[model samples]
Target: MTKIIFKEHDGKEHPVDVENGMTVMEAAIKNMIPGIDADCGGACACATCHVYVDPAWVDKVGKPESMEEDMLDFAFDVRENSRLSCQIKVTDALDGLIVTTPEKQF
Candidate 1:
């Protein structure tokens, strides 16, 4: 399992162990982590799962592709590091990955 840490806008931290092949959004939902509504499931059709990848892991997490980039336009407070959690696959390389949730999902 790869451990990932999610930091909420309020500064709350939720660390979870996610299985390989699972998306960050899946881990958040499974662990009941607040701030990730994931209304579109993992389809990348919505931005409810938007998150800011911590600078330390940004290169590893990479940038959102066309579909995800388009959906991010609807996310609140989008930033250069903003990413749809559903687009991030969990792998050993992502262990200790950190991401921050926006104040609201909108």
Candidate 2:
């Protein structure tokens, strides 16, 4: 399992154990982390699962695809490290992944 740290805008942090092959959004929602709404599940149709990957882990998390990039544009407080959690698949290599929740998700 990978240890994913979800940091909220309010500075609250939620650490969750995510299984390999699961998407970051799925892990957050399953663990009841208060950030990613995942309104469209993991279909990549919604921007509610938007998150800012920790700068230190940016290279490790890699870049999002064109479709994910388009969805991120509609998210709030998007930054250089912005990513759609639903598009990020978990793996052993990303065991200590850290992601930050956006301030808003509408």
Evaluate all candidate structures by whole-model CA lDDT and list the values in order: 0.95, 0.92
Candidate 2, residue 21: lDDT: 98
Q: What residue runs in model 2 are displaced by over 4 Å at the alpha carbon?
A: none
lDDT tens digits, residues 3-106, model 1?
99999999899999999999999999999989999999999999999999999999999878999999999999999999999999999999999999999999
Look at candidate 1 and tell me the lDDT of residue 64. 83
Predicted candidate 2 versus true structure: per-residue lDDT over 5-54, tens digit per residue = 99999889998999999999999999988978999999989899999999
Stretch of 10 with least lDDT, candidate 1: 61-70
* Worst lDDT 10-window in candidate 2: 69-78
Candidate 1 has which clashing residue pairs, if any? none
Compared with the true structure, model 2 gives a TM-score of: 0.97
Tell me the TM-score of each prediction against the true structure: 0.98, 0.97
In model 2, how large is the Cα lDDT of residue 97?
91
